[model samples]
Target: MEHPILFISLILEKLGLPIPHGLIGETFLEKMCQPYMTYTWFVMIFLVVVGKLTLSNIEMIPGKGQNFWEMLIGGMYDFFEENMGRELAEKLFPMIATFGLYIAVANLIGLIPGFMSPTASINTTVALTIIVWVTHHIIGIRAHGLGYIKHFLGPIPVLIPLMLFIEIISNIARLASLSIRLFGNIMAKETLLTILFILAGAYFAPLPIMVLGVLVSLVQAMVFVLLTVVYFGQANEHAH
Candidate 1:
């Protein structure tokens, strides 16, 4: 089972890509059944089983996975508490945590054999960005009501229309920036890794690239999460 770009791209869209394109031309049953019967499925299943077993045995002792999870949760908690305040952070924790976990896990999944990261696709990143954009505005309206619109109007009457126009365009630009940044970084990393493997006989040359890829993956996830926080801050700011 070769995981070609087309196949990977198709699976990503099925999971939830923002762009409109038919990646997989297969019926529902075929897609569902094929996963369970494929080699990738076996690897996934094996990892799940091993992960569970490892956790079970570590009931009295902390291991790498538990430590990593703790660190992630603690870091996010601190970040939100500082920026959003404890009450608001608590209120928004579920949404923030879900996005962070989903994206972080998706990025990490790419490190595994045969599985591609959905975040590597522009469609997926764009969809996520749009959702964030909508969520920020909705939260803003709910919090500040009509005043949410005032945030775009600026302080001077003469600049109201101009400010509004600027705000709207800037918000739209976020969608393109977020999507392109993620897609370009992931695609470049994958392409570089392939070239390295080909040129340096598969093992030694890919080592450094793989290490860099992991760092880049983590950074991308962090960037996405931080940008969401910034958007939330802007949307919820009180217009004076």
Candidate 2:
């Protein structure tokens, strides 16, 4: 599949620092040439720099950067606490916060002229969904020990086989659901902006769409995190 060329890649080529094409060959891990992967690296480094700056100068009187981060992170923590209660929230906040921050940033980065949303890629979304699936199972196991398997079994012993089959399929469906939803939304937003730019010219075409895109980015991130929390909450529950 041919990927769209990005402004960043063009600049890199012009400066004699072109990103390697398919640096890993044609294996499943071959994303080096993808514009989305290039921007994924960009978003990671961008987040790290912003995080460092935000935490570097902790003032007795909070500065703008400190205050902004405090509000964002603190608000998210409070949200988790409310949904999952204090104990589970504390246990899961770091993972939840990482997902929220990364998705939110990745979704918005595409709005910039030289960038693309990593979440706009199916591979990125699938990888994220797999992480959530694995982490939630680990949480369930830690909470329940070897009894985690009971989650797939019904209360009635006679129904265990049937319930297990159904539950297993249901869990697999979640992986598809999470990945496709994020990828579809972000990809659609990017496609729409491209069409509008072509139809009406860049300067005047995309202003309204960009505004809506910002809202979509934040809302989608929130929805993904909230669903993840719900899955974690379910896993932590003692199976009936």
Candidate 3:
């Protein structure tokens, strides 16, 4: 599977850079979406809506848009602040909330005809996992400097190599686990819905599943955010 958001290559191609068509030389466009655009189009739309909602509010007394933004972002702020401390939460809110809200929107977008959630693609989930992994580590290094790597060496000096290897494996596992969990749930849900509509030949058969899918989507997004918080906390342990 070629990663869908290879924007650098796409831009280069647009500029007449002459991208070769194979393996490392070429990038594949996202194939899942139809008619005109892929899930990327929906992602762009979601970002635009979120941007308008968040940026259009500039008053103390809230209007409808401000109220909506406050309820959404404020609740997330409180949740992370309580769990991860005010300073860290404030620093992390933009990235954390963006991922959480984006995933939720992506999942929900599938309910629309002719649209699919970007989260349904493993490429998308893997990209998100990479972002979370890299961001937390960057925070860790910034917070602890040279001492940040000690955590991977284990509590005892004698077992440093073994522990370091284990830690490396564990971190890699986190990337895979995060990506697969999101991808499996989303792909499974969509697949089941398709199966129901085709096999059972009844629209009613998928209604209950669709309702359940909404709940699953919300939970998955929260779980992704919560896991990021856990990583963030782990990385910044020295700060406290």
- Number of clashing pairs per prediction, in order: 0, 0, 0
Q: Can you tell me which runs of candidate 1 are displaced by over 4 Å?
A: 1-67
Better of 1 and 3 by lDDT: 3
User: Which candidate should be chosen as best, given TM-score against the real structure?
Assistant: 2
| Candidate order by decreasing lDDT | 2, 3, 1
The predictions' CA RMSDs to the true structure, in order, are 6.1, 2.9, 6.2
Error of 2 at 120 (Å): 0.7
Q: For candidate 2, which ten residues in a row score worst on lDDT?
A: 22-31
Candidates in order have lDDT scores of: 0.69, 0.85, 0.76
Estimate, for each residue in 1-240, the C-alpha lDDT of model 3 and write its tens digit. Answer: 233334444655677665544323333432222212345565767688877866675898887777887798889899999778889998888889988988888887765544566787777899999999998899889989999998788888898889999999998898899999998998787767666666664547878888999998898999999999988988888632
TM-scores for all predictions = 0.74, 0.87, 0.79
Kindly report which residue pairs in candidate 2 clash with one another: none
Q: Write the per-residue lDDT of candidate 2 for residues 188-223, one digit (tens) a residue.
A: 898887777677854688899999999999999999
Candidate no. 1 TM-score: 0.74
For model 2, the stretches where C-alpha displacement exceeds 4 angstroms are 1-5, 15-30
